[model samples]
Target: AQSVTQLDSHVSVSEGTPVLLRCNYSSSYSPSLFWYVQHPNKGLQLLLKYTSAATLVKGINGFEAEFKKSETSFHLTKPSAHMSDAAEYFCVVSLLTGTASKLTFGTGTRLQVTL
Candidate 1:
């Protein structure tokens, strides 16, 4: 079985400050991890993905995450927070069955950017 957990349900950051969103994951087989962001009434957008290629993965909008096998973590981070970044983020784990992949999503972390 595969599972993912968002360490924080809500993360509040000040504009122009650093942003960090913690996540942990577990899988029986080699897992593919992804971070997705969703703005208000907007469809989920693919931020970044780690598929055993690189430990550090960079995504759109200045977001990035590092895959740490030792700690079983894939935490997302950004150099500075932007008001437009306020949205819900999901940490996802994917397992390839045969031809398709099954995805498991965390409860989600809501990012709030304040001035």
Candidate 2:
């Protein structure tokens, strides 16, 4: 089984400053890591994903995350924050079981931006 742990439930950032959202995962095999964003009353959107292709993966909205096998961590970071970026973020772990992959979502982190 694969699982994800989001360290923080809420993260507040000032507009234009860097942002960080920590996450960790547990999996018996190499799992695919993904970051998803959900705006108010909106559907979830894939921000970025790491599928054993690269250690450092870049995503939309200047967001990026580095997959560290040794640490079992995939923390999302952005160079700067925007008010529009405020939303709920989910760290997901996907594992191939049989023919289809199953996704496990973390607790979710809500990002709040203040001007």
Pick out the ten consecutive residues of candidate 2 with the lowest summed lDDT: 95-104
Q: What is the lDDT of residue 38 in candidate 2?
A: 99
- Candidate 1 lDDT by residue in tens digits, 1-115: 8999999999999999999999999998778999999998999999999999989999999999999999999999999999999999999999898998888999999999999
Residue lDDT tens for model 2, 45-107: 999999999999999989999999999999999999999999999999998879988889999
Q: Which candidate number would show the highest lDDT if scored against the true structure?
A: 2
lDDT of each: 0.96, 0.97
Cα displacement (angstroms), candidate 2, residue 33, comes to 0.6
| Candidate 2 residue-wise lDDT at 26 | 97
Query: Which pairs clash in model 2?
Result: none
After the best TM-score superposition of candidate 1, give how far the Cα of residue 45 lies from its true spot, in angstroms: 0.4
- Model 1 residue 78 CA deviation (Å) reads 0.2
Off by over 4 Å in 1: none
Give the backbone clash total of model 1.
Answer: 0
Show model 2 residue runs off by greater than 4 Å: none
